[model samples]
Target: MSFNNLKSSIGQALQGLSESVSQKTQEMASTWPAYAQVQQRLAQEKLGQITDISQMPREYIDLEDRIDNLQNSIQVLLHVTRVYEEPAYDWPYSTQESVQDWSRAIGSRVQELSRASSASEAGNLLKSPVGPENGPRTLNYALSQASLAVSTLTSSNMPGPNGEGLSSGLIAYSDTQAKLAQIRIAQDTQVQTKFNKQLREILNNPIAKANKYRKDVQYKRVLYDIARTNLQNARPEKEASLRVEMETLEDQFAQITEEATIVMQETLSNTHLLKNVAELAEIQKNYYKQSLELMNDLMPVFNTAKGDDEDFEIDAKKDPLAAKKVVDDDE
Candidate 1:
């Protein structure tokens, strides 16, 4: 071919390729909003599964009950490690010794708070605000209620995220921060702060704190009485063995609870991230040009499809042709 002719052909080919790319780009731009919607919906659904932390879990309840059952029985061991109680009968005990070990256990939890982890832990806490066993309430309701609960504890020093109280204010992101910052705020600032503010105040109060001490003393006396009677009714070796078992169990519970709490904290943090990821998707949605006609809440309607066991099986008895398609009535 001549030089000019060849050059003209190449130019035409380039033009056609550019046009194809432009058309493909336009197609993607038109449909990308659906991508954002799916992301938002999935994130919201997962955030809904974030563990409810506001009312504590049944596992914690069971642990607390177990502790209560122990009472003053081993008040000496509450804060002490096995090192202190080793060799079984080594430690001295007295009814007058008294008991109140919540200080150490709760303090350990507080100390473990990695602002990042705790926020995530707390973020999932409000996933359910109605009864414990239900689908999620709205994110707005869960967060607003958390703010309100925190507000009840606001003081001049701890006036919440802003200097205003939690109930009266919202701790919103003015501008989206880095992922790490978001996690920190959710766990440490929001959830952990609220729990600590309430818990610490009670722990500090003279009268309120006294009640725990009183409860401890009462339980201790009962334990002391039991031990005394056991000395009379049972062998010294068996009584000693029982004390060893109780001490071991208490230590095990504390260790397990601590680890479990860390898992809960991480879940809570991720839950917050889940919601934020959804919200971020919504923000991205604004980037797309969605017409008024395209805007609707279709997710709820889509969830109505269901199947019973019978629905899975072929119902050929009702209609012979229902499950079978005859291309032609051949033979």
Candidate 2:
């Protein structure tokens, strides 16, 4: 062949290759990778609609329980404040026992109403049965009412020891308790969001997906080989088809391994991201420990040595100071 004809043929071949490459690039850019897209969409949906309270981290659940106990503590303190600080000389029931009894009855009434509401469907379940999804809203309403009632008492000052308002102690205690509850609720939400984000990331991780596909392809190759070997005795045509499938699996495994290797290398190269992940783990651990400690403190049985609920009760039979005097006499 002439040199000129050979050069022209080479030029045409190069141009055709270039055009084919361009077309393939355009198709790749325009079309979404179906598997990757579907996985990403699933992760997004998981992050967006993760409302199941049972799925909340243990630390967050502990914090919520602590907040509830703290609110109860505030209510008990409020009753103590009203009964002990304010003088009720003109009132019919003046003794500590009578006042405490009245306060206990009111508390029982509140509990009974709460229990009645909880027995209904709306109170029992939110969007799901196991989630306790509506608990926060119901509890919030109850807390708000109690806070408002305490605020009402503080709206007007009264004569008391050191010229303080009779309601001053209750007001301060309730306000602080409310603020604590609010902060804890906010923290619970933030932690839940963080958990969801982490879950989504893990579910959609490219490296993880690549490794999973690699394993699947490897397993398929083994089965395909067994199939081809079995068919070799009976059917050449079927065996040929099995060999083709096996070749496809081999190619897929090769591609997946290369992609996984690159992802792993890239991940290793990102020192800052690795450092941030480590730091996040440390922070999460410490925060969980602290939250658990706080929750343990809030439990009613925390101080078993302190005494039971009845320990604080004033004896009706003996003189009020008789027990203390016995201690004093022993001393």
Candidate 3:
């Protein structure tokens, strides 16, 4: 037999053994006093089998990899399952529905994370598993009552523009939805804070500073998508103002681009919160230069005006034609 056949055979045998042990443990937990000891012995035996199997040299590297991957997955599942694995337990009636629903949500999230992780592990499953085909059936157990969650927290209907009142369940659902939105915002803020810090450090090196400046500019383009989404979701109360905030952020991005031109200068080491502080420093240098030029140009005009005033007063005191002569000379 090929090594893949052997590994598959081994995997099948291990799976069967695991199920047998689990069944026996469940049965003995209620029927036998030494059930814990029995479970421990089974686990130790399985561990020994796994250790021995891993020591063998095999030609089917892919099969070996899959076997190892499945083993690790099984271990993780076992660890997760352990949380609910009390030897012999009875379900309480009062909070059973809530508990069931919470478990369903957790299971759904786990499945999502699992599929995502698996796709990442093997590179084939790029499409989101939550799409139309298998989504409703596979994810039904994890569904949440959004409207109910919202009403539960606020004890009031979320006001719509039409002035229609929603039920308590809907209010609970809305409350939960708002919480989720806030959580997403918090996560974004946390990520942006890290990016800002990293950009600060990157600005310490001139080349890195330039690279990060370009990166920051490029990355901010993503904000357009985010802004569009936010705009789509924005309620009538806040949509206009929210758009303005997004616009301001975009304007800041543009200002940063304009400032980036200053990085051509030699001194580029000192840095700050913006992505390209050295470039901003150059912007400041240019701003100062323009201000100096303006003053230089204005200074002569002011001085001449003042001098002309003095000459007018002297000419008025002595000869009127003297003031005209001064004006003609200036022209």
Q: Which candidate number would show the highest TM-score if scored against the true structure?
A: 2
- Which residue runs does candidate 1 get wrong by more than 4 Å? 1-235, 273-277, 280-288, 293-331
Displacement of the residue 259 alpha carbon in candidate 2, Å? 4.4
lDDT by residue (tens digit), candidate 3, 294-324: 3333322322232211321233235444444
Ranking by TM-score: 2, 1, 3
C-alpha lDDT of all candidate models, in order: 0.39, 0.45, 0.44
| Residue 179 error, candidate 1, Å | 36
State how far residue 184 of model 2 sits from its true place (Å).
Answer: 1.8
TM-score of 3: 0.18
Error of 2 at 26 (Å): 25
lDDT of 3 at 226: 47
lDDT of 1 by residue, 198-265 (tens): 33343344223334443443333333333344444777668787666545544544454455445433
* Superior candidate under lDDT, 1 versus 3: 3
- Full candidate order by lDDT, most accurate first: 2, 3, 1
- In candidate 1, residue 256 scores what lDDT? 48
- Quote the lDDT for 172 in model 3: 35
The candidate scoring highest on lDDT is 2
Cα RMSD (angstroms) for every candidate in the order listed: 40.0, 22.0, 35.9
